[model samples]
Target: MESNSSLGTALLPEESTETSFWRKVLDVEEVKKQVLFSLPMILTNAFYYAITLVSVMFAGHLGELELAGATLANSWATVSGFAFMIGLSGALETLCGQGFGAKTYRVLGIYLQASCIISCFFSVIISIIWFYTEPILILLHQEPQIAKKADLYMKYLIPAVFAFGFVQNVLRFLQTQSILMPLVLFSGLPFALHFGIVYTLVHWTGLGFKGASLASSISLWISLILLATYVVCSKKFEHTWGGFSSESFRHIVTNLRLSLPSAAMVCLEYWAFEILVLLAGLMPDAAITTSVIAMCVNTEAIAFNFTYGLSAAASTRVSNELGAENPGRAKTAMAVALKLVVLLALVLVLALVFGHNIWAGFFSDSTLIIKGFASMTPLLAISISVDSFQGVLSGVARGCGWQHLVVVANLVTFYGIGMPIAVLLGFKFKLYAKGLWIGLICGLSSQAATLLLITFRTRWTRIDLSAEREQGTLDSV
Candidate 1:
């Protein structure tokens, strides 16, 4: 008599077949396991979101002008930092996932070190962007008082997270090796330290606002130290010291190569939204308070972080299967990720929708702005769904070394079409806030469609294992 486990195996027939892809994704039992892995990722992002909301609420106490300054400055900081980080980490995803699939442990450590080295270089560049932020604000014709505050915020905030990014890239590299808990568990360390330092020193110390920002910088470095210690003690870097070989430099080069195109694509998309926000601030009634606008954008961002977390996991999963020469598995993994992402997005949107009237109470007590934000629920729903698809496809492309195409597609979709149309609707049509968000929908929607189409039509089966095996070159992704 066949046991139940053996009978189940007999019913399944095979693991690697393409026909089995759907079953692997949908099997009631397997589906539960995949969704379960995603839960920790969701909770981790929820903590990060909580930190942002707390920061905003506290900044709101500093007054509307200060809140606006924080909003604009943090917008720039978040988008630019993301562009720079993704420019490098995309390559780490590809290399480490593939290396793990191939059981090449030494290559994994080399990739990690190279990514950290380049991330340090970028941290310096991002800090300088802050220094020049004042001139850019002036060029945008921001009010002089607001511009001064925004510049201060930019300068102070960018440096706070500089060294911290190196730790994040290392975490992403380790994630591809499938040991993700250390990275996930320790991510909140920086925030805890940041809150304690900023809260205590901001009031107790005489340093004022600059003191608050500096405290965050101190916290960031401490978190970096803690994570770096874990990496060293975990023995994850042992085999990577391959005598300063050219291949090591190539790993750094490879990360940037993949990262640059992806960055260009995403940066263009982000810049469109930034432009709209600026345009909204330029409108007549906007100056009374930008709080309504800030709440709308930032609250939605809390949800967007989930997409990022899942995308990271998807990139590794798809890349691993591809490296193992299991295209069927890769396709299955992407499908599973896509479905799971939308499921998560809808669940989140429902929470946002049901709590719509009450959402802004946490950020501000002004009933008027809360009403304005409640009106924005539908747009938020559509936008989150659009952005979710774009995120997943980017993951799929990264897994397959399709970085260059993503860049080109994003450029055309965002700048070539979406931005032009968005600006026309925003400034010329006189639609104000509604127009700005509508434009965002256009930009992200087009980019998402292009990514989905490109990923779907390609033949995922022809993986070049021997070429990847070569130690000489690693291209953009």
Candidate 2:
């Protein structure tokens, strides 16, 4: 009798036999497992972004200047620091996910350590850039007062960058193995703790904006420590983690081959939106436009966490199936993930359409900011829907070791196509924030279409785990 651990191999069967499309799509067992694996991650990501929104809300109430300053600072941190760390850590989604499926469990720990080392090194570079943020913003023609405040906020948040790097590495490490419950527990505790910490420091202690930054940094560190402790003590990780190995140091070049392109792909998408906020700051009512646009971006970011959760699940499923040499099952996982995200996107679009005003009001009581956000809500909804599909496809690409391909696609679609249109319509035509978002929608639509085509045309059987193991590349364990 086959054990439950060997069931994935049964999913392969014989390719000579044909299966109906609907039967593959209606695989209830696979769908159930994917949903169970994805739910905790979705809730955890929602909590993570909610904490960020709460910080932004605290800053928003401090004053218009503080709101704009913190918005710019957070945007910079995301584009320059957090996105890079998350992207770099994503290499593990391929390595560890496949390693687990291939029963090369020890390699998962090695890849996790390698990812942490690289991420910490990058954090130092980002911190230095944060120290000089004021000059950089000024050079970009930002208001001098706002630039100064943004610089201060970034300076206070530097410690959190390193903390966040470890957080992301652990997140990917646990996620690839489908050990998600701890993520929810650990992340939720800090999220609840963050509000009190921010309130006490900001209002009672009179730290104001800096206090908010400090609160967030401290909360992140606490979460990291808790997560680290769990990873260390859990018996489930025993086989995968056999203490820190020097072997981690030897894989720099090999890991970078995936990490760098993954970083670029993520950075391009993230920085594009940050650029939108920066450009909005250059508009006539710089503070108001920046505030409204930032709010819209924040709202969209929360929605993104949902799709991102699905993306992670898709990556894990596809990579695991491919590693187990079940190409048919891998393709089925891709189909089911795409279907799920599209349904989620549709539900989100309706909510945004009907509840735009109420949602905007949560961020600010200012009528002007709320009104501005309302005008752009439709565009935001459309962009989110398009981005939902693209996010899942990118995950598929990562699972299939196509990060380098997607980097090129992102560059051409976002930078080559989207950025120019955004600038031309936004500044040249003076359409401002709305125009910038419209241009972004165009770019996202292009990326989604291209990735879908690529996914469809992929020769799944040719994606061999044996070849990867032989080359000592991704599956080197």
Candidate 3:
């Protein structure tokens, strides 16, 4: 009987041809696992993003001037404050992720504290800049009235920066441990509540435009409080979240080494999109060009946010596997992530291809703007495809603690190669909006290619963070 059972088990593959073929091609289970992991993260990120956008929407209905001011303020907040905060927290993806894997559990809390400290320090600096936004905008040749309105919106938005930083850092701390479902709840709840808060302030309380910015501040803090409470109270983190210690202050310098480069890696890419919008303002049909380019930027941001979940998953998987001293498994994990990215990108590109006009209509009623977006749809598709590849790769880089190398890649590719061609084609060659997007596509392709090379040529190894902890530096990498 035992021999017959063994014989039947051995012959199972012959009966299931599809399963055998997939087994030969890829790890079907791992792909499914990543897809499941990515969904919650996608929802969490989208929810957090919607909190601010919803505020802008509420304020936009007040008046055209209100809309203009609120939009500019929101964009400025993202570039100078929110993007930098998100980047600074990226260090924890490496530190906390690997530490959890290596069973150096207590170190995760210490690193989280250190990252939060760093965020607070930078938020102060950025707040000072936000305070003087009126002068800065005027200096940059913005209309004085619009600049003043932006300045008003920014001042009220300042408190949100500190909250945003803490929220992001805590997110990384939890994300690294695969504590994800709570994130969707915590982030989604605040975002849902934010709509009511903005409405009350904008309409019921009579704060007007200032209320929209202030509402974002309140909602972000709500998110932080919920997340902080969970991290503090949950038994799931008992091994990792030791109560705060003075020791974290000592690790600030170590966190900064990676955090600074991570911040630059994010900021460079973000600034490039804003720069394109600014250049559009200089075009012959500045109104139409600026509107279309801004829409494109927003469209790209939305797509990236959608893929960001997979990127986060890739980072966590690679870092955790590496920390477990399984380099081959880490490589296989990244391969699976890339495959998923390709599949997801194709779906997104197809959606954009078939529904380009419908998507554009949401942003504007102007036929000219809609037509312009339709014309740029093909280039946008290519860029989105490449951007998806790079997003996962960038997450892998964060996991590998290679932000320094990635930053240099971003600087050289986006600033050195991408921007020069954009200028030449945009102004010199007369391509205008299409030319600007084409230049951006060039940058995205170059960046994706560079990151791909780095991932392949570089060694995959875990940082001995325990050793670094004892040595007082992260140089052990």
Ranking by lDDT: 3, 2, 1
Deviation (Å) of 28 in candidate 2: 1.8
- The C-alpha local distance difference test score for the whole of candidate 1 amounts to 0.68
Candidate lDDT values, in order: 0.68, 0.85, 0.85
Clashes within 3 Å, all models in order: 2, 0, 0
* lDDT for each residue of candidate 2 in 179-246, tens digit (9 for 90 to 100): 99999999999999999999998999867888878887888898999999999999989998888889
Worst 10 residues of 1 by lDDT: 468-477
**TM-score ranking, high to low:** 2, 3, 1
Q: What does candidate 3's lDDT look like per residue over 1-477, in tens digits?
A: 999999999988887987888876777877877888899999988888888878876776676566556666777788888999999999999888877777778888899999999999999999999999999877766556766888999999999999999999999998999888999999999998998899999999968889999999999999999999999999998888888889899889889988999999999998887788767767776556766777787788878888899999999888888777777777888999898899889999999999999987765666887899999999999999999999999998888778999999999999988888888899999999888888888898999999999999976654443325556443222
Cand. 2 TM to true fold? 0.93
Off by over 4 Å in 3: 1-11, 15-17, 63-65, 285-288, 461-477
Q: Which is better, 1 or 2, measured by TM-score?
A: 2
118-172: candidate 1 lDDT, tens digit per residue: 7778888888877887787778876566667668766766765565567566666
Top-TM-score structure, candidate number:
2
Alpha-carbon shift of residue 152 in model 3 (angstroms): 2.7
Which pairs of residues have clashing backbones in candidate 2?
A: none
